[model samples]
Target: MASTTIQRSAARTEVEGAARTERPRGAIAFGLTRIAIGWLFLWAFLDKAFALGFATGRAEDGSIDFFAKGQAWLNGGSPTEGVLRYATKGPLAGFFQSLAGAAWVDWVYMLSMLLIGGALVLGVATRLAAVGGAIWMALFYLATSIWPEYNPVVDEHIVYILVLVGLAQIGAGRYLGLQERWERSALVRRFPVLR
Candidate 1:
């Protein structure tokens, strides 16, 4: 039993030593970056839902209107219609255009943005969120920004996907997020992939 006691003490010492050590470099910055990207998605969901005069809340004359009720999703606005129908270009234009203004499409896109943004911000289900966000960005990339004058390929969408993949692979949620607590949950413990 002495050997067992000694081993437990050694493990405790190691854990204590790790706790006293400095945080890994860029840990906080990584978490902040995750939150920022998450907010980007969250803000899009908010702006589209409320027509807060940024991208969604615009008058017919192209003027910004803070209270453009008709432009908001909550007020009958179609979030996917404008881009899917008019803005989609390139070879996939027809495919994307075919999906324009569909209520289900709008619902899916809006809900995805909310889920991804909320997950990233809260640092819960980050891996799933990252994957979902990356796929969503890919769809947007294919829908509109497939062809840019600046380059043959590569754009903000691609960059965002890469960042998301990185965040997921690194478990960025654990850094400043509730992921540690989430990981200990019964559901997450049973379904490790959800972590």
Candidate 2:
């Protein structure tokens, strides 16, 4: 009877441990940072996609309109056309410009923003999101200013990359996000990177 009791206790303990995710004291900080970075991507996507006019979809009079049909992606405005064609200044200008206004490229960029932002914000698939977001930011850095005025080898993109790596390394998503439950999912078990 004692042996059976011990076995039951052990099993119960194991299940409890598995069900309870531990959050470090610093979890809040990392989770907040993740949300902030995610918002950068998400906000950009919203502004561009809907032309909210903080940066895009401005009228000829420089007035702002919510969901204005003039320059929104929905209205056929190209999210990247102005930047790639007119604002690209680095040695890769031609390359960047070549991708300007292409419907397919716009779709890809928009989708990247939505997916990466959503993943990071929701605290699921953060590793994959970090990888994809880092690549996207790096490309943006390369296109706009290969030789940044203030620094030769560092910029916001690089900082973001470092933070992303740190987040992945520490499992930032597990702290306050849905990461623990997400990892227990069978699909994530099969693909650890999705964690």
Candidate 3:
């Protein structure tokens, strides 16, 4: 009985000492928050990419393509001109109109959606993804601002972007993601700028 008590005391002391040597109390909590947000991004991408039925509808019914319909809904049935007309005024309207039907414009928009969505969800380049997501949301706001129902002036997108940015800036991935492994590699050490 005496030996068991001594062993218990020693174990308790070791645990206390180890706790004292750990990082800040908030690091683990913050890492968990990062994991949650990262999952949100990943889910968003998966939902849209697979047509798990979001803004575009089901993926299997040939309804995964939301870009064209989104642009149309923002505009006035002329997919390209609608959003621009809503956001641009006077002289800027002409400039925006010129690019409304540009093929590259749609391509850029689609690619941005894919990349930003992928990055945020994967927690790979979260900072870049968050920034890009913000820009995308901002443009969406611009396009839909004309009407309350069409735009609503507020949405979860803003919150998502901010959270993503915060997570990236804090290097949350280093604590709760593959980024932790990536950060320790010789390649990352050599390219310190990657962080």
Candidate 4:
């Protein structure tokens, strides 16, 4: 009887080993996708930081005012005629518009871009970055949504946000990011669902 039990266990192990040997389904593809997504955020941050000149359109200022750019677009050659004015025209618009040309605006925009883009590329606080990225993309979508032909209905930025959200939901960082360390920490382990 003991011999028979041992034989059965060995058979089970063999079967499991065989299953493990089977080709994995799209693992490489998924990893590549994640890396590509990270690259996107990295590129965006770099592009805006060095070349695009943030929201202020003041590359000389060396700061990024993300919202300021939108404002400029709206007041200037923006396709979204009243959208920016309508949303920002209230007391809030007046307040931010005041800061539009200010140096502080550049600092804020640069910092925000760095934080959001850095965290996303590194996969640290992935869920947080994902949510933030989504909001950012949504705003862009709003700006572009006003014009169908020039801006179009579909944008890659939106897709990247969605992918970020999905990866965060699955804790994709565990496989290849700081999220693995994050997840194992007391903060995450205690909650077990924080991420």
- Candidate 4: where are CA atoms >4 Å away? 1-24, 52-105, 150-152, 185-195
The deviation in Å at residue 171 for candidate 1 is 0.4
Clashes of each: 0, 0, 3, 3
How do the residues 37-101 of candidate 4 rate in per-residue lDDT, one tens digit apiece? Answer: 66665565454444344423454456654434443433332322333444443234554344444
Q: Scored by CA lDDT, what does every candidate get?
A: 0.89, 0.85, 0.55, 0.55
lDDT of 3 by residue, 135-169 (tens): 76655544443233435545565566576667667
Model 2 off-target regions past 4 Å?
1-21
TM-score of 1: 0.85
**Candidates 3 and 4 compared by TM-score, better number:** 4
Order the candidates by TM-score, highest first: 1, 2, 4, 3
Of the candidates numbered 1 and 3, which has the greater TM-score value? 1
* TM-score of each candidate structure, all chains considered together: 0.85, 0.83, 0.50, 0.53
Query: At residue 113, what lDDT does model 2 achieve?
Result: 93
lDDT tens per residue, model 1, 143-194: 8998864778889999999999999988889878888899899999899988
Instruction: Tell me how far the alpha carbon of residue 113 in candidate 3 is from the true structure, in angstroms, after superposition.
Output: 3.3
Per-residue lDDT of 9-114 in model 2, one digit per residue for the tens? 9999988886655655677999999889888888889999899988886777988876776568887788888888987877899999999889899999999999
Q: How far is candidate 3 from the true structure (C-alpha RMSD, Å)?
A: 8.4
Inter-residue clash pairs, candidate 4 = 55-65, 55-69, 64-109
Candidate 3 lDDT for residue 147: 34
